[model samples]
Target: MKFPQYFSLLIVSSLLFACSNESDSDTEKSGIPAVITPVPLDTYFPPITRTDEWETVSIETLGWNENQVDNLYTYLEDNDTDAFIILKDGRIVIEKYFGDFTKDDNHAWNSAGKNLTSMLTGIAQQEEFLSITDATSQYLGEGWSSLTIDQELSITIKNQLTMTTGLDYNVEDAFCTDPECLIYLNDIGTTWYYHNAPYTLLDDVIANATNTDFNSYFSEKIKEPIGMQGLFIKVGYNNVFFSTARSMARFGLLNLNQGTWDDTPILLDTAYFNSMTNSSQDLNLSYGYLYWLNGKSSYRVPGSEVEFTGSLIPNAPADLYAGLGKNDQKLYMVPSLDLVIVRMGSASSEIQLGPSGFDNELWGLINEIIQ
Candidate 1:
């Protein structure tokens, strides 16, 4: 019965036009025209130094509209944003801190932490520690849920990653991971609900599969090698990650490069990486292993049953994908544009789990400045 949140917001619709301009005489003589290809910018291949500091690019050098950029910042401030950053070709283009927040201040990624867990799960699979196709009970032991052993064994790690565990989310606390809380709703792989308990249990899956603590495994596999700084802390039944804005950017950069950092391969499973970022199931074409995708024909939001038509963020590039969390902690990347953006702060007045109206509005502002 849930309704769409931004049903009335303006949807920007503009097709990217690729054309060639040539002299009429030449076109008539050859029956063809030369198409000019844009020279690739050096920013496209910026050095990936595994250091704390990142190289930066000036707005003037990028030729972005200054007045519009100011307007974008003003809009962000008005919306209670704490930290905002934009990376072009892995180099910082715009970085800003508002109120008392500083570059070094840590912020919780909330549900966005699921993206990290997804990556680690893939890494575990690559190392032959476990296969995602294996049943969840394989690692967590049987009877972890109140369901029968066969019913419990029906759910697989990939189902948890894709939110297709068919676990009942109608309990008193959706976030509760207790056996009593995880009741079965539909059969596995038949339903897609943004249930939290099944997703939260992935930490245990990774821990048992690797025979190491979740945080330690993450540190050894991803953080230390990529120069990322963060730690996952337990909050109630949820394991939320806290990290600086730049650290979040580093993760986005790693994903943007298809699981490689500075030519170092962190996730060697190309097939898994492709499947993780692309559509993982038919129920949610706009969702991939914990990541949200744009440019899809339709999308469904968390806590809502209605599937809205068109792209998730109309103003964003068609190739845009994101790790969006509560209160709009966002890690957005557009592969075609070679862009990465991060935003961390309090929730907007209107709240949803992943993509929201704020996304379209922010992208509108970005399009203006970058045009």
Candidate 2:
């Protein structure tokens, strides 16, 4: 959903590469090319002047089933969902808050907020504050990690963005930010693991590079501009974001429009936007900068070394990409349908860091309604 134009550009480049390599007849494709259905650019971005003035559309108007509405809510409520929303062309088709949770109540994004950090990094890079290729120590300074100067210097922002920093995950606490906890596992870029220490350090890198606090920079660049009402809180070693469900949907809308808020270009670096949402590393085809991509040939989930052999969510759209959190918080977008879906709540039962069994089960239920 982030880049329809980039995928169009990719198709052109891929055709050239596919023809040039006689050896790459079948297995060596650059990207999974698909005919992206045109997203409706006429969609409205909710104004910040009145935060409560978002537009709405009915599912019946979109030819979705009314009978299944009850089924959808039933599943959401039964599974401990606090809020759920489905947007078509930036207009709400369904928005519901369960139990004591209201539309304005704040819920933690957990790991889904990693998408917010990824976007801010892109914005920072576009403004020339930093480059992803630069050694992380350039900002974090030497000895930020237990690695030697040379070893630490070998790690780049791109490595951290792609989860290929080769940081040790076999620790007593993977979330620990101390230098002693960041032991070197393999050579930089040679291994891929979802180690949080390297990722959490990205806040320091952004703060040092931009000469601004991460939260301040985020507010100035993204939150205030797009009418988003959210704040990042330092929780232990991580900076987790919290916002109302509607604010989360606003971000989903922004991403659906390729990092734009109406006519204003919030993140106009098309190349960086493309890279942020597409495959950033070969080791995990389903991961972008911090987003979970779908429709790739294979994908590896968090905390697991084994690679699964299919799309991340089999019941969902092939082009769906998402920001998934530890407790089943989800932000999913499908460009073909001009759709953005967000779910924020407590975990269905246990805390899982996404691509969980609930994803398939929920999407299976959603399929019946959307169809």
Candidate 3:
């Protein structure tokens, strides 16, 4: 769960680009036609204070044998599952739950929310909130300007999304107070480190450009259109969402379709989807726009012949990208298989602390059913 915290006003500024095909326009290659009228900034929803209304799905005919489904449920029940859902070829293949979780339960996306954060950056570019090429200096201004000129020159929205900010990779700096201590140390796009602070800084960029809180902007722009009843929780100084497994699956489904939700084009451009799922950083070739990719480039458990090394679950598809959270929350998308798998739970033991052998195990079972 991300808490919305205070941000330094020291940043850069840029004028909103018209979503045009001009040389300066960021929307040209994206092919999502430019908007005639920019979306109003005032439409943003306030921090969630009302009761969350859930979208209901009646599940009676997914066709899995009750025993088989029960076996999966039993497995999760024994392991602390809050919810799990599987979508095959855009259809709900299975949905199961245990341990105080329900269809309406709102669980924090934790780091799982990072992908959504990245996706929103693309969406913001599509809507002309800010261009992808706009330097970080444009939004983060004089406060950031105090840094060495070369450091200021290297910062961009792309670096933030790709986790290539050239910042230090120290876990102790997870929630650093002084942004200056974290200076740009390498080429902007050349390095990759799993830094949450830079990623979280995006909320300020989006909010500053759009003139609203990140939660409301995301709710209006992303969740509502897809019929996802999710909320970006803002407690004290952090902002994150609490969503049900089904809704998380839907978010993955949106990615599986390359940023389209149903017939509506929420992302405005699918090109952003391509670059997002594919590698965006050189160091960690296993990560995309705030989303983690499984298979070849990733580190796997020792002596696991499952050979999941870089293989996205064939049952789940090799192109699968996931939003992984602390304590075992996952929203996985497989493009070729047209599948989305969501799991939300607390870890029963320290087992989830490493490359979960469970992912390989779960795929082993799901493959049998798919075959």
Candidate 4:
């Protein structure tokens, strides 16, 4: 779900028009054009609700006094961190960025948007939009429904959420297209591949079930309630959304609070929180329902051996969950630390969505100060 750096501006322009035909005139009625205003890097720190909650600690306090966070800033500046913010104990702890990124700049969350969509699924199911147990074909109509007679019969919403749909991730046309496009590579529940097309179709499932567009539904149910002025961008996919790094942090903090937003039960199905944070697929123990898990020590790499290492913190509480995107756009929530750390920027690495060793390294550094 991560867009290339070249598309950042393109996405912003599209964001303004995302709801143009989608029945979201209220956004314009409120006088907020979908237009994105660029913000300077240094001024991107969002106003904290309560600054006293932030306990600033040096890298040394986190066991890396010699490891300057300023060095990290220098690296980000040389690279591209449009916007980044970190929260510890519900307060801003570290906020920094580079280039034109700012507090108000609405950067694309890419696949990280999937994590939000996954939560929306829980909400939809809670509202009885459709049960997770329903077969994918149930909502997808004839084209996708035909798969039942064939090998695709096993596919289900659960499989889609867990990414165990068993469809070949290699097919370009089918990979991106719906129903007619996807051919079962293996059987359902057999493989783990980052298949985008099937995941995108889940948007339609959600949309059809509720008789609403994904973006509007999400805003009314999740974003608006949490006070996050988020705009879900409609890219080539069916249900992609865009939000400021601050808005993204708001969602992560909601998860950090286990589905409660300011004492309100925005997500009625709070039981799904733990399941969303834990691995749902047997193939990749590090991934959950669109969210990445930090509790695992091994990662499967394509064309390479499985890499193994300890997690960020020894005996770290297993409740830490995250939404990760390309170029290192991250929303990390750790219930144990009562912390939500957000980093949005173009890192030096081109493939930012893989098993980013950076997560462990950065968390290790942050934990030094937390403990």
Candidate 5:
């Protein structure tokens, strides 16, 4: 299916004109043009407080078209979105609670919670708790999978993070964490498949490596320091997290700063952070270590073998990346724009997993408003 191209021409024109018309004075004052000067990162590090409120940026100050912004919210509400928020320079630029949802309503992160697990796993490695290079069986024990000891040993922690574990997704219960459900499909790193069983197993890896409960480890290491409130509750075989929309935004802001919360370094392993947000393997350029990356030449979605051409979300900025969840729960970060966005609620459509057509449509609306 092709994405809508209604705003394609206008978007291209706006970007090109902005790039080609930098004045000499602008260049002299700063190496970059004034219009494109990055918002200082230090200016908006949210105070690490236990309160439910966050600082916000006025829409007028953002110079956003008010009519378009209203229309954006209307469109979101029409599509079953329970909550939507847009953050500019770490301040809430647009915050809306739809239906019966309020700012304090807790919502499930679904698969988007994987992004948090990925970050915490990096911290675990940094603290000498575990190593990505280590085999998955090393921590989970040798019989965690149905594969032979040798075949399972070949699957490393890195494979799990990159979705290159070569685990079979054709089983009766793909989400099942039982050893019998984790059948080997190919040699490690030979293919990339968005299998949930392997990804969910990362929790066990972290738990075993750190000798602490997953949620407690997360609280002490990440949530407490950043003033984020949430818990990874077990749902069947999956450990999904639930939090308020603002807490989701906080995590996005943390990622926007590359794992740092304000001046404090929540994840001091810079190398892991870089690898975690970029393409993690040669198989899928659009996938990092559990996060979804945009601006890649091609991408592969869950349950599909066909490769789609172009960036994952064409209407979003080229530098955009996201932690997308089932039912359209989204946490997007655009470093170039100094922006972070969150959306939570029921499924916008029948699509499951990450990078759905609704993403393109929603971003198209966002482009109309922000431009």
Candidate 6:
């Protein structure tokens, strides 16, 4: 029921050309109208090889309603989507680009790149480079935060991973990593706050733990293995990751496969993988290690203490865990469905941040097909 809107248009164009080329003899031999079927979707074969080739499957093969595709694209186009992709079993099911944005163009992951930090953290742990339970100061050194040394000692690497670092969220700049900016909000592990400073310091954590440069280590450990092309670029106090849409899909597929690529294990620590995608704390039922979890009975969002009652994306599958970033950058992984979805571009609306109405509305369209 779900496919990119462009697919049907391309097929219709192909059909029109076919009809024009048809001859009486050809028609007589067929005794019926020529049917145009795209061989590239499913028939192309294999998952992405990181080459120019990426296999695709036919919407007809999945029996999804093609009628909804146009509507989906209409909504996307209106919302300023630059690039969107849906991968099934690691094969691309839907890939659409808008305006001048193409497969080769780079886009920022925004906060969705936090998922990359989460993955690298796990890899750091797996390789015995760091432990999530270790105190943050143990790696970053003391006085990293304005908190008293005793109070600072209480903050752990797991706290950063879970957004429970107890760092103040009311500061003028939540993204500020300066020690003076990272004020103490509450006792460590007491509350779940969505602050970016502690999360961003994780860059230092990985770099220090691995005794190597952050991006270099990332490229060597995760990117190269999965054939991802992205690097963290320093922008003010934030180190934002930018890459092509296909690269985002590749990372989603890696998580969909539970940290494996082509049967090769990238994250050997099974426990970290399990914990990374599940609730890391009781305070936030809909959050894992920087990943937004769906299907929880209740959820919370950044800048709000009020817990909203419902799944993170009610229209999405219950098992979906996503990396939602600023301006609606998205990377969704549904293990149950063996699906990975990626969306990248400018904000569709004025309200910019993760988990907007855009998510629920878009999923409504997705459900029309996938359901």
TM-score-best of 3 and 4:
4
The CA lDDT at 238 in model 6 is 93
Can you tell me which runs of candidate 6 are displaced by over 4 Å?
1-49
How well is each residue in 1-371 modelled by candidate 1, as lDDT tens digits? 74465542322111112122334555778877556443337544333344545677777677778778888889999999999999988878899999999998999999887889999999999999999999999999977898888889999999999999988888899999999988888999987888889999999999999999999999999988788888999999999999999889889989999998876899999999999999999998899999999999988889976778998899999898899999998999889988899999988768777778999999999999788
Q: Which residue window of length 10 is worst by lDDT in model 3? A: 39-48
TM-score for model 4?
0.76
Residues 1-371 of candidate 6: C-alpha lDDT, one tens digit per residue? 97799998999999988887776668788879667663332212234446777777766766777778888889999999999998877777789999999999999999999999999999999889888999989899989989999999999999998889888999999889999998887988989878888999999999999999999999988888888887899998999999999999988988887888877788888888889999889999999999999999998898788889989898999999999999999999998877889999888786555778889999999888776
Candidates 1 and 2 compared: the better one by TM-score is 2
Which candidate do you rate higher for lDDT, 1 or 2? 2
Q: How large an RMSD does model 6 have?
A: 10.0
Runs of candidate 5 with Cα error greater than 4 angstroms are 1-42
- Indicate the residue-level lDDT of 167 in model 6: 84
Off by over 4 Å in 1: 1-52
TM-score of each: 0.87, 0.88, 0.74, 0.76, 0.88, 0.87
lDDT of 5 by residue, 7-76 (tens): 7877888888877665555678777644643333444766678675677767666667777887788889
Write the residue-wise lDDT of candidate 2 on 99-177 in tens digits: 9999989999999998999999999999999999999999998889899889999999999899999888998999998
Clashing pairs in 6: 1-64, 1-65, 1-369, 2-369, 41-56, 41-57, 42-56, 42-57
- Decide which is better by TM-score, 1 or 5: 5
What's the residue-level lDDT of 149 in candidate 3? 69
lDDT value for candidate 2? 0.89
Quote the lDDT for 121 in model 2. Answer: 92
> Which candidate model has the greater lDDT, 2 or 6?
2
